[model samples]
Target: MPKTIDDLSTPCLLIEKERLEANCRQMQARARAEGVALRPHTKTHKMLSLAALQKSHGARGITVAKVGEAEVFAAAGFDDICIAYTVVGAEKSARIAALAPGISFCIDSLEGARQASAVFAGLGRTVRVLLEIDAGYGRCGRTWDDPSLVTFARHVADLPGLALGGILTHEGNAYQPHQAATVMAEARDRMLSVAVRLGDAGLATRGRFVISVGSTPSANVFRNAHRDGFSITEIRPGNYVFNDLTQVNLGVCSFKQCALTVLTTVVSQHRGAGGAVRFFLDAGRKVLTSDRAPLSDTYGQLLYHARTMAPHPHARLTNLSEEHGWGAVRGGSTLTVGDRVRIVPNHACVVVNTQDEAYLVDGDEVLNTWRVDARGHVQ
Candidate 1:
């Protein structure tokens, strides 16, 4: 027998459907106003239903971080997808070639381009390849000023079975800023400048040169700064779908709009010295992610019941082990065991990895459940 929303087990992930729909619409509207295609990254939710909702809200396509993720989405009917990772190795290259007829993959090194070209040679099909540029994030991308970048692009263009699809970058460093506005402006400028440089090198004139940029903190800035000649045709942000404690601490979103939360039952309550009340919950790093950025310390944020769904100002998560979370309630108020509480994780992506399925809830009512099909696809 399948379990409905309400009859499920505790210490589970719950997603508010209405809030998720609102977030999808908000990003879609912003993409429309900016005249850029929204290709939201599916690594956040990893659920086909949410991806469909994004498409219905005017998204051109979706983005995935790994080949397995792309396969999962493609099997779910997302054909026009982009795998935003550097292609390498024969196994991955074969998978990329197999997916070439339906989706696109990114390339950053000459060796990867050559491998991709060799793998797709016999099908008479040209794989759409995007030259990844190193923005502020020092991740896997060729440096913008690397003299060999144009040579590599030309090499990829000259290849018999490959088509240079333009440049892509993830400005992930923007999340470290003290203010959202400043980070957004800098990330937008960096991406736009790279796109212009790629165009100046005659990359866009060949065909549909997709200049993709993304990261939730930077998407808002890109939307405001869109213009012609920059060639920024797509944006691929993932975390916007389920805002988390890190985003809230960094001022990216508020607590109310957060869609994902882990519902845990209070297992124990004891008294500490100096008349302090200690509360322990069954949820810990195993349920809530411990992947906190520089902004937050605890594994997740504790939500206390009030008049509505507001987080209690004095409620805070003080410590966390593998399977236990400890916290202190202000004023030493007593809390009985078996009480239910909701915890907002520090990082939504990591939380998605922790659960195999999540409940779709609306207000206080449970709606349905969806499998996290693309979990653990780290490659």
Candidate 2:
């Protein structure tokens, strides 16, 4: 076993194994109690081992954002996978076809459906697809109440080598600056109304139709939505496995539930002309990331130490350069040049993608090292 954080290099990513497992259990239990399937999004961790752990905790399947990411997980033996983004182009569709027979993906427009259908047809297989409904998040997908939805459904039904499996949506607006419960309710009601409307169109009578909705901030609303008997088939939350400062700010999770942090060391310290102490860390926009939570302007929060994973509160990450983070000491924090600190980034998903590997830790003891095999698979 690796000894301590000293054995690892500076600015390394660390995953608190116990906290991660606990997070998985909590999400799984919540989904089960509400009688909904948890098909967690794997784009957060991008690690096969952790995805397997989620499966072990009763996830129905895994969700990825790209065909490249799906290939990585499928090669690692994850059979049921859903690409939650719109897939277009011949090359991407071909790559997606190779992973077929157990793959499903999202379709937001008729042209995408035609392209996917044509490509999969040439490969001699039918591809299952879920129509993406824009439930007022306004990012991607056709509007839920669009009169053209039935026309698109009819077109998809008549297309060769393309099967309309169900409807899917992401209530991403929940991450916006709003009361967590309020956004949750809006997300639940909007998506449920659309799902019910679509299900009544005779498509759901085929037994393959499903209504899926997810986003970590609105996960509880999904549970309550399901408990309210709206026939929500699956919940696809990704970041619940590693809560971040954003989730903490949204009240989706507490700091104790966050499972990942940047193990950074203080490399330099100096006082301004006004006699205020400022320290720079080895972690910066490259690792800790500059994703600011709407609730806080700080890039990240510095942890007290290994004995206490609690945020120091006094040491605020005020600014970030390419390879350095400037932290300000307030409330009488006496940080020194050689002090070691853990930083809980504003967003964990993008932070994990910045590194090639992460150290799995249980307290200060390094349990093992896992490669972030899909780090740059953004294509």
Candidate 3:
């Protein structure tokens, strides 16, 4: 049956099948050329179908943010997974041990290592752990040159039921919306130097150490690092699969490269006394999300139509309430009640979390539906 946005309900998440496939293939190609393994972060889309597609494209594995998410992917046959966030506490530790055979994680301290040791030992399994190094993101991890790094590494290596997988970093600060390339490159360099320094200090054991670093903005940096002999073993970029307004603003991907969008319908229109046109859409902060990048001032960008991803230069998504998205165009819009429009949200990850399923479309034809199966697995 023929299916389009008009034929479906309003405020629905949509994924362009062609663009998403191209994005995956391009990232894989770049990784192959640069000699680094691609283990794309699956926290953005969190669908087993897309995860399978990534694996088919030669990705080494997948990265998730939580143990629950890793369990979701693992149950779906994604054996190799990394919970990039720190793994602590008994509840999450037990969950991690249950899925520990093929899963790994990031840790920054000896205490976290001990926690894993206790739980995994009780469960009779070992867990691979990577040291999280701070590469200027400042969210987590010790600084690259911190004197205590080697001490913590040695402590983690000595712990029972734990294997030092390697080192990794999230250059999350590179999402500056401007100057991202330079910042991303610098973060990669810092992360690479730390890996080299630690390796030289005899931190590598059992086998060749895995030096992984990435974020959507710093994905190219991983390529450049590999080409420059930086010995980076893996890259974990999540947002590259569905470039949103944030990625577009950071210049990581063009609007045409973005694959995910929201299909919204105009519910009402109002005109100000000064001759301004304002329209309310069914999609609001609950649907599109309010995660704006540094400079972009809207929840999402307005696409002219569902068939075309082109944005109306004058149209802007100004405000969003629980159920209403208020937008304005400088001149006027011909849109009236029940008109459909597509919105490229600012953050595809957050938007995906707000939905249960997404329509997979190839051009104007709806091909299938993908469940956000791992959504809300934030534990």
- Which regions of candidate 2 deviate over 4 angstroms? 224-230
lDDT of 1 by residue, 57-76 (tens): 88998999899998888777
Tens digits of per-residue lDDT for model 2, 257-340: 999989988899987667887889999899987789878979987889755798886778889999999888785557777778
Q: List the residue pairs that clash in candidate 3.
A: none
RMSD to the hidden true structure, all candidates: 2.3, 1.9, 2.0
lDDT of 3: 0.84
Looking at candidate 1, the ten consecutive residues that score lowest on lDDT are 1-10
Per-residue accuracy of model 3 over 164-268 as CA lDDT, tens digit each: 878888888878766567766776677667766666667773237788888888785544554233467888989999998888887788999999999989999
Q: Which residue ranges in model 1 land beyond 4 Å of their true spot?
A: 1-6, 224-228, 273-275
Model 1 lDDT, residue 113, Cα: 81
**lDDT at residue 301 of model 3 (Cα atoms):** 89
Candidate 3 regions exceeding 4 Å error are 205-207, 224-230
User: Model 1 scores what on Cα lDDT?
Assistant: 0.78
lDDT of 2: 0.84
What TM-score would candidate 2 get against the native?
0.95
